[model samples]
Target: MEVASVLHMNGGTGEASYAKNSLLQQKVMSITKPIRDEAIRRIYNGKLPKCLAFADLGCSSGPNTLFMTCELIETVEMLCRELNHESPEYIIFLNDLPGNDFNNIFKFVECFKQNLNTRVVGGIGKCYITGLPASFYERILPTSSLHFVHSSCSVHWMSQVPKGIENNKGNICMASSSPLDVRNSYYHQFQRDFSLFLKCRARELVEGGSMVLTLTGRSTSGPLSNESHYIWELLAEALNDMVLEGIIKEDQIDSFNIPVYYPSSSELQLEIEKEGSFTLNRLEVFEVSWNAACGEEHNDNSEGYKVAQLIRAAAEPLLVNHFGEAIIDDVFHRYQHILADRMSKEKTVLLNLVVSLTKTT
Candidate 1:
């Protein structure tokens, strides 16, 4: 499978909105603290050796990444100090898809240079920011080197879309119909990618090292449902309107598909079990409340829409490929409208999961 960039609403050349969304940041930390704490505990108890390395996979650029990394380091550092253990030598690795905006991340690094020494007890540990794709974990870290790994809002995205879709008999373009096949294909790909991830990370994680991962997820036997389908459909409808207006060709829309997947906890558990090298420590579910791009409740004077635009910009390539560039703005507008309406009718919720696992010694 060729690794392609996943459509992200919060991506662009400048700053990402999610990177600045303090509310979202707070919510992420609230859900991720327990997982981080557990990983720290494992590292402190000799379950994972002390003075070992730590990393944050898919650590996108921005305040969010900096905030997350600093928080994780603080948590681990505090635990080590409390236990009278040598503060673990930390290696902060920030990874993302190849196309991620590194400039912003670099800027963020500069902002933290002064505070780094102050944050660590003994001295500032080695901090490095580098890029790594979702598939090629082997190249990112050295063998048997990492003690704790943390990832959030990542990993549900596949390296690429499933194969054999062009010839498939059903609605291959839309994720609503043929969900079983879609999910199965997605599961298979995740199984392969995750297996490779473990294999790569396994080489880098010393005996008993642990990983904490959080990502978007869905619950149901198979395929995403209609309620969940509204977002895509609204975008699709906007694209169709653009087509009618002679903005882009219909064929163009048909050629594009999102190369991502949302897995259920059961599906993930099954795959992890198959890996056979890690022990599941904990799994938890939560719903994140996201204000729509055009929510009336949002302070209209705020920078919320700018953040939404950034996310849309990141997703533009995929959206244009699928829906056509001509309809992109319309699609976004319609999506915002639909999202607002849905929120008005009832709260729109996004499902997410956080899991912690320890490598077998």
Candidate 2:
């Protein structure tokens, strides 16, 4: 499958758009704020650049697109204030695949800059924003240009579907019923993609540059036992129901596979070591509710519906490309019902892996 062409979140601010349903991703950014802040502090303390160029890879559309840019600017402003130092000029690169909603994000740029002019203390540094549509797996930036790089809820997506998972039928992702070969194929693909990611970033970032990445990951050593697997299982259940009803062909299910992998912390560490261009400073794992509506109490039905919307916004394009657009509503409706039943029996949560890294000199 052509992941870059088809794997974008639903665009625009419609009810099912990623813009409306990305509170869960925003929550993820919130959860990892301290780590990102610390990385910025270290970069500033170690070597403050005159023109700090930072890139947000896989910067999908929505409020979360510029969330890091704003946070980083605020932190630098605060640092400059505390030290009575001059604020450096800022250049922010918002990057994602070609199919991403760059137009939607750009619509808010001028407004964001105006806010910065008034909100940034002393109007410290002039900020520039640009939209870069490309894959992070390749070299997208000039060598040693970036001082700080941040990506959240990204990089878990492989560059393409693994080559030999043809037998992984009845499922769109890795599952417990998958054969050993299928699991190995997925892991090997992640190893290659992530290693290349590190190598490319090592070249793009300046010496002593810092990166903080947050990814959907598995808590346990076994890939299939994680919540992500179960989540896909639920979707597959919905798809299987459609197949039985002759709404979609069984071969379609057999042929479709999502190009995402949830690696364990150990797996990530190994890939980093093998790449040998960055030093791993911290790797933290945390869990959050799948519902995304934390702090408020909601019945299973409500929570389930919320989770379904979140996944639909992120997964709809890929599904539509494979199964056609006609079955989306019915499939998700069935998915919500299944998820509600499951939530009534037990809670569903997503495990996130946040890692901080420094480009080795």
Candidate 3:
């Protein structure tokens, strides 16, 4: 399972070009709009159930999942009109990895029900989008029936691909180049996929539910250098320059890798306090500058070099399937001219964390 075969051959070209680039949808909805406005003010101050139920967990599929599900239903209808309550019954869901792109997220939920039948926010009413594929560490929800669980850039991804890197030789990831045996084998598979995603979202959350997790991490803790392991050494030097131009074959680069995992923030608060049903309310940390012109100087281009050329055009078909398509467009045009000459010499950085838990029951 080469990470579920590169998510079933790049899950519909990574969720249909995840909203055809609007500067990577404002760097993933500007860090997921303050964790969806603090999980709609802690589910309207813990009153909870209004039949709300939201879930994006690895959503991925066009128009940045309807622009982060219309900014999480306009921040849960402005926290149910500042807690007066009532405007609920809005289940969204939209997970991923069952070879996602659920028909382009159900055609972007029928263009979000024809743009909410002609948009009318403050007037409320309209946001029922649904499209669950599954694989959020695989429980496929439904126990207590969630109340909110957003996920950006998906849970530091890893449902596979860390298994004993073939008896470790070519470094089976722990941030390779062997840093303490690949960070104790990437923190033992990020503590077994974050304790089976907090025991399957704590049996599908309900008791004071709430979870917001943005990803792409690493703010020191050993290994991860060479300019923060520049995207796995620029995808293992574009698959060893496509196996030295023979076009894929060195045992398919020792049978590919990259299920990815990048925790921090005290190793994700020690796996959400050893899966005791969450609590951490926030763990912030931001720096994302994929280099282009570290924000500003827009007209002169470099929205992080056009979101690093839409993540190198959605990782160009897994970099031309282990580098081949004639040296995959000259190795992504020399990796976008060395990431735009290292953003004109200020180097680059990306880190990012953004937590916010809750659950506790």
Span of ten consecutive residues with least summed lDDT in model 2 = 292-301
Q: How high is each candidate's TM-score?
A: 0.83, 0.97, 0.34
lDDT of 2 at 286: 91
Candidate 2 TM-score over all chains jointly: 0.97
The TM-score-based order of candidates, best leading, equals 2, 1, 3
Model 1 spans > 4 angstroms off: 5-26, 47-50, 119-139, 167-174, 226-230, 292-314, 320-327
Say which prediction, candidate 1 or candidate 2, comes out ahead on TM-score: 2
What pairs collide in candidate 3?
19-63, 174-182
* Residue 203 lDDT, candidate 1, scale 0-100: 76
User: Which prediction has the highest lDDT against the true structure?
Assistant: 2
Question: Which of candidates 2 and 3 is the stronger one according to lDDT?
Answer: 2
RMSD to true structure for each model, in Å: 3.8, 1.3, 16.7
Measure candidate 2: CA RMSD. 1.3
Tens digits of per-residue lDDT for model 2, 1-361: 6898888888999989988888888989999999999999999988977788899999999888877788889999899888888999999999999999999999998888778768886775888899899999999999999999999999998899999999999988888888889999998999999989999999999999999999999877786564667888899999999999999999999999989899988898889888898889999999988777422546755877788888898899999999889999999999999988887777688888999999995
Backbone clashes in candidate 3 total: 2
